[model samples]
Target: MKRVLTTLSAALLVIACENSKGPELTGDKPPETAGDTSEGDSETGPDPDDPPVVTSAGPTTEGETDTGTTGDTTCSFVCDTTGGTGPDIQCDNWGQDCPDGQKCAAYANDGGFSWNALKCVPADAAGGEVGDPCTVEGNGVSGIDSCAFGSMCWAVDPESGQGVCVALCTGSPEAAQCAPAGTTCVVANEGVLNLCLPQCDPLLQNCESGDLCLPNPLDQSAFVCILDASGESGTTFDPCEYGNACDAGFVCQDPIFASECDPGAKGCCLPYCDLSDPECPGANQDCLAWFEAGMAPPGYENVGYCGIPQG
Candidate 1:
């Protein structure tokens, strides 16, 4: 029951950084590793830890330590001199927030997010250091690094003076080193349902490797994530259509898939009247009208759609 905001729906998650216009940066180098940083020459570009001034929007969080690496194994940064979108951390608006599996951070053309930002380590990466802070690059009063993928951040809101990193963008959560071998930690629905559904809710679903909790598209009322259904019941829900046969006294109606009781056999109606009784045999016979008047099953609820046409 979860739907992810499309990569295009920047407003759905963290602040939309896509539209921000700024100078672009492009360099030749493999993107940074997840959560952890690899050694590099200072000329290779300062480690992501250095607080490079983002030409467009600033960092996702204020006091964001210019330290460590960011992004996932495959996620990389390319300087867009054309200035099409702001940054990969792009979002539609400030209210959309970041997607479940992903986080929001101040990314720049300088490639700091990947090279200097925190590496995408597992939740338990760094030897079970769940909250230990690792310096990506910038100096800070506390030597104890404290940030992770998807964790909240506080960047200065250009619109509002208050800082807000509501969310951060890092490599895939599952890619983090915290999880054990052969066991991937992802958002709720990270597998087969990735295309059909987006996002998962941690409260309702347990994200596996590479997965994060998100909301549902059908109804935002609840949150869910995609997961392996191999162990789950294979049952699926289908709706009823028009012109199907019924036992007696019912009709098909709107939200047709859910199946509801309809007595009127008008307006693209389906069979629902009871024919077992001899009195309701003619074509004009109204099944539900008669049944409701104390003529059929005491308490009947047709769980299934209209039955096959016997005639």
Candidate 2:
């Protein structure tokens, strides 16, 4: 809605300028010279010969977004009947414990972008099923999207509210799962974005759209594609917490797994290497199996990490 209004405002300005011009000097008077700055109207104010002012009360459509500045509160609600403040309508994201036509979804209520609240919303919006293009009702945090039953819109553009439907992780959070074999469930944003993300090869790092391939958080056996949140400083031995926090060819490892890592650090970035030709950066270190015996997915059996191998 903001986008539309801004566009409309621009168009209106163009039309007004075109209308305000001195009627092209059609009848008798010759057209003014190019540098003629005759004091008809100053650049700072409206034109004297401009047409009647045009105004729009609001959007013609019933549902339009109110997304403002980025720092403005993203914490919006779908059921804020109690004057935009009330107890959250929590529900099971896995079970989707809502009425027959509704689905449970996570959202935010605090000032930040994290999904710290839940709500049940009607599922009769727009796009349904996974991978479909969709839109959000209010802002992105409204928890009311155009996806049906078991999916929620992901990768939403905050201003436009446009996104794609992604399947919510099924089963319990502890034992979360996805449908397709190659896709892994990704639980993120304080568990609001529980969707199936595609798996990738740590060696090849063949993720779509520059996403990083890292070890699956559910299990370290295989790699999964995730959005890279590790900005410029993602180099070797960089202290990190999340697996994707490391740049490409590196994965987050505990101090025990990362040789010479800061003794008190929680985790650090380490390189992945081919098991067939083992290599390590530190002295006496060896590329060890990242996953347990016989656990790596097919074609990725040779994936290993540089670490101090135990005898």
Who wins the TM-score comparison? Answer: 2
What are the per-residue Cα lDDT tens digits for candidate 2 across 65-176? 1111111223221112212232354776766767888888766555323343567888874457787878776555557888977887655643455766777788864677
Evaluate model 2: give its lDDT.
0.48
What lDDT tens digits, residue by residue, belong to model 1 across residues 51-159?
A: 1111222345532222122112122232221222333324312122445533223333343322111111222122212223233223111111234443321222234
Instruction: For candidate 2, give the lDDT of residue 258.
Output: 51
State every prediction's TM-score relative to the real structure: 0.19, 0.63
Candidate 2 stretches with Cα past 4 Å from truth are: 1-89, 137-139, 157-161, 188-193, 258-260
Candidate 1 stretches with Cα past 4 Å from truth are 1-107, 111-128, 133-136, 139-213, 216-311
**Cα lDDT, all candidates:** 0.22, 0.48
Residue 258 shift from truth in candidate 2, angstroms: 4.3
